[model samples]
Target: MILPEIKREGERYFLSSFKLPDKLTFAGQPIPLDNWQVRERIEYEFYQFLEDQGESIILAKRTGRCFPPAEKQLADAGLPDDLKYMLLVESKCVAAAYSKAKASGPWQFIPSTGRRYRLKSDAVRDDRRNLEMSTEAAVKYLRYLKDFEQNDWFMAMASYNAGEERVRRLLKDQNITDYWKMHGPRETMRYVPRIIAAKEIYSQPEKYLGLSKKDLYMPMETETVTVNVKDSKRALASIAEEFGTYFLELKMLNPEFKKDVLPRGTYQMKVPRQTCPSRCFKQDKTP
Candidate 1:
């Protein structure tokens, strides 16, 4: 077997001589590589991943940790397990991620789209940063898009980055159904390909990014607590202290607390797991 080759200059080592995998699919839908453009676009995405090896490696490390809940939710919904890669491509697994377009959270939902998916985002609270809620909303949106696009997952994915109307227009006006064959805005064009490339690299981190299984960051299980706040920050602090976790650490767990406070009204949030050493550390008296 001929292994992929790598070469190093004084400053940089480049990955090359790696043939594209014999087969690539996204969301259980086979990528139509028979089309030269489809093959090129997907291969272009592969090289793009290789080009940002450091960042891609970091994202790969994170994917293991971030993907479990997504996989679980999709599995529960009977959706494709591979859709988790789309989350990674969207925000690199950062729950509090924000884009200049005002898209927020791990799923990178803009306000209107977030609202369409029943995600609330405002000055006081943004469920977009709530990992579980955002993932659930995204799954619903993707499911709807796929169904709208006649069960073509890639087209649905492109529709996600673009929008349903634009995708519909392209499909109708261009007299074509294939994403690779249609002309879309640059960002939308690159979206699904990036997702596909991410799935490939993350699935074979050892082969692609040279990361070992042990190096992968897996999700840390956490417990949830529902707390209601009315008085002030003191109320939340008290809850955190009771859980044997610091307020700052609690905020890390729940970034939806834009001001270190819970969303208005009844909302259940993940607090701290006393069983987990990392989550249940003693508070510093000095502070």
Candidate 2:
């Protein structure tokens, strides 16, 4: 589908004075304009709800964690730097965060979508909530969307929030290619802006919002240990005592363990950087 340029009239909106194809399809599926109405309405309402909740502050806190690796991933995917802030809104930078919709990890990917991206979600190990693993998957998915949707970051992100099929249909119905000009639902309209607001706060935290410099959560540095134990809690307790640190610290460091139990097999456990020097796991007993 070809999108028309949008223009603003005196206190009103007008579609670009161009004609477009009547039908559009993405990935071989027909974009149903009628079905997109529900999605558009819901998206708009969600955007308004976030706006009323002081989205700027939430975005600021979320974007502060765009470290070099994540930044590089965004660049490699051909996505805008502002798109990184979507992670803040989606999962609050918490790798272990899960949604009521069963979306898990920093990207809040659903089980099916996670599987499509090759993110393992099994009884023994859920890579959806693993920081490094999930981030890698997210980058792959983003790159796929960008490639499929003409490299428009807005469409790519909208496709991320709403399914790619849905966004494609909206673009077809609106006869609009530019995300800012496309009229469908409220959420799509505000989705990009919320992300932009988040980027703004992240780029200049003190200027955009009143966040404490010292209170920022810095990323933790740790070493991974391969353990054969089935129960991570027991192993953590044993190791913590050996290292003279609390079990809670170990738990915090390894958020992938959903039930405080590592699945039976070889599991990757993260230990503090300082603990590596002491060889905490090799010690005999808890301190």
Return the clash pairs for model 1, or none: none
TM-score of each prediction: 0.86, 0.70
Worst 10 residues of 1 by lDDT: 1-10
lDDT tens digits, residue span 1-287, model 1:
33234543444444665567768878778887777877788788888777776788898898877888898999999999888988787888998899899999999999998998898876767899988889999989988997898998888888889889988998899999777788989899888888888788788988877788789887665677666665543455766786777677777788876765543466566765556454453452323
- Evaluated at residue 65, the lDDT of candidate 2 is 48
Error of 2 at 178 (Å): 2.1
Worst 10 residues of 2 by lDDT: 12-21
> What TM-score does prediction 2 earn?
0.70
Model 1 stretches astray by more than 4 angstroms: 1-13, 232-239, 261-267, 276-287
